[model samples]
Target chain A: MIQLTDIQRDFQVGDQQVHALRDINLQVAAGEYISIMGPSGSGKSTLLNMIGLLDQPTAGHYQLDGQDVTTLSDEQQARTRREKIGFVFQFFHLVPRLTAAQNIALPLVLAGMSEKERNKKVTQALTQMGIADRAEHRPDQLSGGQRQRVAIARATVIGPAVLLADEPTGNLDSASGIEVVKILEQLNTNGLTLLVVTHDEALGKRARRRIHMKDGLIEHDTLQNHPSLANP
Target chain B: MKTRDATRFAFDALRGYRTRTLLMLLAMSIGVASVLVLTSLGEAARRYVTGEFASLGTNLIIVLPGKSETTGGGSPNLLGGTTRDLTLNDALAVSRSSLINHMAPLIIGSAPVSVRNLQRDVMVVGTTSSLLDVRQWHLGKGQFLPETDIDRASFVTVLGSTLKQELFGAKNALGEWVRIGDRRFRVVGIMAAQGRSFDIDVENVAFVPVASAQMLFNTQSLFRILLDTRSRESIPRAIEHIRRTLRERHQGEEDVTIITQDAVLATFDKILRALTLTVAGIAAISLAVAGILIMNVMLVAVSQRTTEIGLLKALGAPRRQIIRLIMTEAALLSSMGAGLGLLVGQIGSNLIGYFYPALPLGAPWWAFVAAIGVALGTGLLFSLLPARRAAQLDPVQALARR
Candidate 1:
């Protein structure tokens, strides 16, 4: 349900043009669980961001669910992102002032959903994330794992088609990281397309299909019949 | 996003940054309050001046001997101007106009008056008995000068309340004789206490018959002629008729200046109204300053909330929605500040009114509306740049910020 052809992203760092993503091509079907792994500056995060519609490719074509999304207007891109993409950032990015439920309800509010429906969806998200009791707490009041869970809930509350996680468990402890990964795996099992970008070898190995990158180019791509439970 | 939700979001943001919000509110409210209070003060001064002019009898006219320069011709005030003394006959001739209801020839001078052992220098006003009615000054005791011919030199005089008090403290002064400029005159009336009018202390002056004042001052020219028209409609006709008669009597030369009290009042009215507007404009500058303050604070707020803005954009909020959110916050702060300022200004005005009860210190309705409108307008206008900056923020760059 995702396609990229000759996608090239370049950044200008002072006087030189740095190619963040060079001649990237990828395709993935719906319900696929994939992990992109690389060292820093390998453009793995840039690829996920491109797939999430947060960044534009300098030279390329991107198709999402049969629509050529690379040609969409900024407004259309935002609409597509709203309707078909969800993102969980390493930093969580929860509005510090909003409570857990309110943070989850943000996408619904932006979609002009009625207050009643927004509250219902927020409550369901809280329950689905297993943080129903912490819905009233702000981001600062929550632990690292709980904050990540809230961020996940916010990402999925709108029922987007693809979930993009950039270092989902990067900041969590070992126990909480395992729990968060299990939750993401459970959602993937329920047929949600999940693409995770991480530098952790063990977490990357848990995916059904894995891609490794070095210097803005994919080094390897492999599909394992039986995913290894290297860490969990 | 729904407007209500946007507003609520903006409000929450403001509440989150309470100190910044409060400082902006204070600046805005102080600006509006100054506008209201300054305008009210200006309006009060205008009203006070207007009231003082209203105290001068309506339909009253004054005839001065020398014409003001603006009326044209050789300047009557200049030494070479064809200026002529206005005599009793000229006053008598002007009195013949059918439009003129009552006329009083006036002579003003300073002279030393003594009652036995007590002596003091005092202002002396000479006018006919009709001066009492024309000036609307009431007598505290005894009677005013009898109505007689204009040239009749009556020995009767009227003592102003203060002069009477100074000359004969606890004693009756109605029948007392006082020597004024070496002439003995009997006090026929004691004027009621009049503080001051047009900078002249009426309470310290003495009044005598016009003919007697002419004889005492050794001059035939009347200082001024005060006239009261039959009605408000008769004033223009009375002025025209007096000008014609005076011109005829003064060798057909229009040397006298005839000014209606309304014209003088209108001039003062126009000046005071302009003054009020000027002060109010000066006060509105403070509102612009407040607008700049809002812009600065909003810019800081946008920077501080960079991540939150990026998150909102990521959540699918449009650029216009982001702008609307910031604009709503600024508008809310402005309206609240304007409301609070109105309250404070009214309180300040009431306090001033309480202390100085004579001045009508009410702010005009337009001032109130303009103050609020300007506050809201400036607040919105100034916040536009910051709102636009917030809207233009790249979601990727913003989210990437620590």
Candidate 2:
């Protein structure tokens, strides 16, 4: 569950203040599938980043899982982010030097998990992502789809409560994009909360609940009539 | 992160740029090696000078005819500053102490000597038979001058080996009469070849009886009186007894200056030691330069790895962990450099020792320790700014830099 009450974010550029987010209020229950769609500079990505705990609101209150996360210290924010949230960037920011398995094992390693448990978790993540054979390969050695899969594995390896995907299939071909969208939908059907921000209309229409934004404000938030394809 | 993981991460970064890593290592090692080599050379020079002084003579003391001008902390002024005359009788009084082994009354002058056909200017040292013991010079042939009395003039002369060869040309110089300073004297002995020492060449000098020397040089004052004490412990006692006896003999006037060989050696030792430390300090500057180079290289490395740092932060690494990782890399770099430097410096010192075995050129263990310590310290200290920069980078801004 997530709640943002009157969250505002500002950036100062050359003696001018630019408001990136303003007067935003939102609430989401557990196990929700949401898509945020907008043109560039509409602050859709900014909203997703706020929910992901990467950027702090200049003036607002944010509560996640009953804790007021906006008041948390930087360290506490990092801990909360580590424990309950996962982020998938459009760039698939895999450490170029680490193999796929090592990349997936990074969060666990940062958590000081023992080597045996880390290996077990990483192996399981590799198998679940269907890229167990690519575990030994570096990011440069993998295809676009495989790299995205590794990034997804890295994100979900901590078993976080919410998965935030910023243009998850933006760089992939249609076939691979469909494959990734299906995988995200499958995870959502199994009760993982998913919030995706995208410019792809096809991918945006796939979500049952869609939110449209423009000029640092949410233009629309609505639920369309659709039964769960995953359950069907 | 665990220490082992930190180390591995550091090694990975270093391994990514092998050429840059090698260059940094080279710079650090060269700095440390120079410190070690220069300090060793300083120490070797000190020991060499000390050793040279040790070989001059053993437990010997000199009685000069003048008071020492120093305020008790300078070298013994031997040949100058005398206010009163010291005669052979004064030498006799100092030789009568129980701790005195023997005394050689010395009157040095230089004049021309000639045989029937050969002529050369030669240094003339006037001493008694005790010269053989006091100077530690051995006769190459025949006998030295005999001791009858300080005032007795025996027209017998002793020739050094070179002087003998100059006058007699391989013929026997003993019992040969040579004209020296307008007086004809018989050569009683030939000295061995002794190269320059104490500004006197025993091989180029001729010896004669003390009274003969006084008559020839036309002076009554003795130049110096060389005394060998009975034991090392008795030197202080001998000095006290000579001062007392000479003061009594000279009507209670302490005109003669007495100096033990230890004092002259100690003065040189102190001066050379100070010189050595100054040179070592000059060498230590290179280490600081190396430290600056480390800072420069580390600054570049941080910029190059900005994205990686941002990623690590995103993965939940703390700011302190980022700093630790950079510092760990610096420490590893410097430690390896220090190890290589130790090897190079010891090899350089051994080469110097091999070329000139007289200098015991062992770099003091402290020099080795200091070089290594300074190398590691500078490495860590220099990387602080770069590490801070890496830690302060905003994860979003850093990643956006591409």
Candidate 3:
């Protein structure tokens, strides 16, 4: 679960001031699947970045599991991000020098897990993602869909409570994009909260909740009851 | 992150750019090599000067005609303008002072000497038979001029070892008649070889009685007075006595220079040390330039590896780790260079000694340690800029870059 109160982010571009996020307030409970839809400069990525702890807000507070993360030190923030949140980017951001297994093992490595435990966990995650055969291959050697799958495996390898994806399938083909969405949907089905920031209406509509943003503000936050969640 | 893990990562990164690392190493190696070579040259020169001084007689003093202006002016030279023409009287006075063991008035000149139609320029040293005893000049064949020869002005000469070899080959030159500047003199003995002194071949000289030399050369003045003390500890008192005696004889004028073996050797050592320092200083500049080259190369590397730095930071690597990683690369380059330089320097020093036996190149362990210290310090100093740059990069901005 995450909470945001009156979040505002400002950027200085040369002489002019730009409002990236303005007076934004939002919350999500456990196992919630939320999609943030907006045009360019609508603060979707900015909000996602804030929730991911990759950037800080110029004003207001963010509470992650009841702790005020906005006032945390850089190191503390990084530790929180490392332990509780995982990011899946549109660019796949897998270290080019590391193999899929190493990429997937990164979160655990940051947490100071033993090599043996890391290897075991990475193996299990690879098998779980159906990418076990390609575990030893580097990102450049893998296809776009395979790279995205590897990215997902890396994101969820640490068993974080929340997954934040920013245009995760933006660079993939439709079929690959659908495959990545299905994988994300499956992770969501397993009780992991998923937040996807996207411009694709059809993809955004599939989430149980859709927050449409514009001009640095959240214009709408709509929740749809999912048949799967209802049954579970 | 742990230091071991950081070192491993650094090593891997360096391995990734092997050629670049090698180039940086080569630059630093050149610096270390320059320092080693120049410093070794200095060390050799100092040893050579010290050895040369040792070869000259210790506890012995030479009283020259004119005092050096640097030591302050006193009595003017009697022979020429500045050289003293100390007589046998001055020598006798110093000898009777109880501080002296042996003393002699010496006159030095060069003339063409011929033996059996073979002629060569020979240094002619004129002194009493006591000169031979004071200098430890032993006779290999026949006998030197006796005390009676100085009283009688005997036309007898003692041939140096090389002179005998040159004129007589393997044959006997002793007791043979040799012509010196048109005067025929009998070679009564051949002096044993004394090797090189002050770069001159000491064996190429001829010795004759001082009385005969004065008559032959038409000079009544003496060029120098040589004195030997009974013991090394008595040299300073003997020198003080001679200085006081000379000052009294020359009316309190310090014109005549009293140069002891120790003073001459000390002066030689000072000159050699200064020369070594100057050469070493110049070479140190090249080393500094080499350090600069390392810094420049490391700066470029830091810039090129910016993305890598960002990736590491994003992976939860602390700023100190990034700094350590960059510094390790620099230290690795410098230390390797220093090792190679030590090898190169040792070989260079040995080669110098091999070619010139007079110049001894002794590279002590401290020199090697100094080389390493210099290299490591240079590495740390030069790496500061790049390390700071790497540490100061924004992780988010860095991660954003392709």
Number of the top-ranking candidate, with TM-score as the measure: 1
lDDT tens digits by residue: candidate 3, A20-56: 9999999999999999999998989889888888778
In model 2, the runs with Cα more than 4 Å from the true position are A175-192, A224-232, B70-82, B102-216
**DockQ of candidate 2 relative to the true structure:** 0.44
Query: Which of the CAPRI classes, incorrect, acceptable, medium or high, describes model 2?
Result: acceptable
DockQ winner, 1 or 2: 1
Instruction: List TM-score per model, in order.
Output: 0.94, 0.85, 0.83
TM-score of chain A, model 3? 0.96
Model 2 chain B: worst 10 consecutive residues (lDDT sum): B73-82
Rank by DockQ, descending? 1, 2, 3
Shift of residue B148 alpha carbon in model 2, Å = 6.9
User: Native contacts recovered by candidate 3, as a share?
Assistant: 0.13
Evaluated at residue A123, the lDDT of candidate 1 is 93
lDDT of 2: 0.85
lDDT accuracy of residue B231 in candidate 2: 84
Estimate the TM-score for candidate 1. Answer: 0.94
lDDT of each: 0.89, 0.85, 0.79
List residue ranges in candidate 3 displaced over 4 A: A94-162, A170-193, A198-207, A227-232, B69-84, B96-105, B116-118, B127-154, B158-172, B188-195, B245-255, B364-369
Please state the CAPRI-style docking class of candidate 1: medium
